[model samples]
Target: TILLGITKASLATDSFLSAASFQETARVLTDAAIEGKQDSLAGLKENVIIGKLIPAATGLPRYRQLTVAVEGYKAREVDELDIAAS
Candidate 1:
């Protein structure tokens, strides 16, 4: 999706997965994991998340600009969130 969006300014692949999709897919995959199915479903999920889905979902021009603008805010928030634990 990121490649598509960058190359063509649009997505070519379907990215209809949502919270419900995650829950359902995770439920099934967890069952598979428990049964020792040994497929790379977890890896597939991670690849989808980090490789394509997250960037596309948050990579719109406006959000990209906002991300640049608010990066410090986020960093400060993260520092605050982690300070107590650390």
Candidate 2:
């Protein structure tokens, strides 16, 4: 029935919009089924559907932290009037 609804919705309009709506519907249905219980890490859709951590980024074992350089040159302050006069 869910698949049928999704198929109909997809056919009725754009597939992308239908897909997003279907995902949201699936999430609501799944949440209702589990009665607000936490979802275990499973499929990508399930993780995303239930708002659990996705199986990418930090979930991966080989993930590395990125270091950013904070040091940079400071800009000199100039008056707007001086620039306009020039």
Candidate 3:
């Protein structure tokens, strides 16, 4: 039971930043550096640490490749939009 708890805590996060704030500061950083580890956005804490919103049920990074083509509508720059709005 004790071993299970230990394993659970260790496996909860592989983030060096999180671990650094936790117990094994040097060991975690050393292991990560020696292994040439790059931080990933695969975990919730990583996203939170970087100030990024979590991916909701919307399954978004939404609108990244969104390009709208309107028939008979000429697309103008943002500056033009301000002038036109005025």
Candidate 4:
């Protein structure tokens, strides 16, 4: 997971700084998740929560931080960081 995260961060900081849009980012991420390139959106810890709503942490890292709350434990936070890190 960390690998993918680094790659994505690298891409954003080094290449897509001027061209990447949130919509585009979301689309790519979602597509990757749906396409099996990613394991699951349930692993990115930086944004995931097992039982709470992931607050809007603004800025670049937000796109990589994909948080998700578990079905039963909606109050806890789960970081699905493994989804795309590597």
Candidate 5:
């Protein structure tokens, strides 16, 4: 049936996306290890392996970016900046 075919296609697409995500994460971790840099961003597996907080249902401090407040400066809206042409 057409419905079954659609379901199969959806499952295959989900599997492919999952595999690609895993591959990318693995590549990043490998590169970090080679460079002797510690990946402080903890995820499920990493937290479990290190026996720390799993970043869920915890009162941990969230990551924040340091921003500087500029005065008397008008920022231009650049919604269509093309980097490829530069």
Candidate 6:
């Protein structure tokens, strides 16, 4: 398994919003804007950042139904993800 420091791992996340909010705020946001990146808010951090409820099913067995906002969320994917920069 590859070992990555927490900061490194967070920085490497696919969601630019999560990365920008976590650390290196300016750089991450700048890079994301330049690249026209879109955040899917698929992870816990991303949801927390947007004040959205966590999906019931994140495919991680350990986190089943942690704080699901919508019932039956597992049946369909969220069509929209909030990507507002903080």
Model number with the top lDDT = 6
Candidate 6: pairs in clash: none
**Per-residue accuracy of model 5 over 1-86 as CA lDDT, tens digit each:** 45545444443332333222444556555655676765454455455454555565431434122234579877543221221122
Query: Which scores better on TM-score, 2 or 6?
Result: 6
TM-scores of the models, in the order given: 0.21, 0.26, 0.45, 0.19, 0.29, 0.57
Shift in Å, residue 83, candidate 2? 43
Per TM-score, the best of the predicted structures is 6
RMSD of each: 12.2, 14.2, 8.2, 14.2, 16.0, 9.3
Candidate 2 regions with alpha-carbon error over 4 angstroms: 1-40, 61-86
Q: What is the lDDT of residue 13 in candidate 5?
A: 33
Please tell me which model should have the higher lDDT, number 2 or number 3.
3
Clashing pairs in 2: none
Q: In what order do the candidates fall by lDDT, top score first?
A: 6, 3, 2, 5, 4, 1
Number of colliding residue pairs in model 6: 0
Stretches off by above 4 angstroms in model 4 are 1-24, 40-86
> lDDT at 2 for candidate 2?
50
In the range 1-86, model 6's lDDT, one tens digit per residue, is 88899999989888998888878999999999999999987877787777775654543445533454667566543322322221
Candidate 6 error regions (>4 Å): 57-86
Model 4 — which ten-residue stretch has the worst lDDT? 14-23
Q: Which is the better candidate, 1 or 3, if ranked by TM-score? A: 3
Candidate 1 on 1-86: residue-level lDDT in tens? Answer: 23433423312213322221444556555655576653232333444554432234343334433424354455323332242244
Worst 10 residues of 3 by lDDT: 77-86
Model 1 residue runs over 4 Å out of place are 1-23, 40-46, 50-86
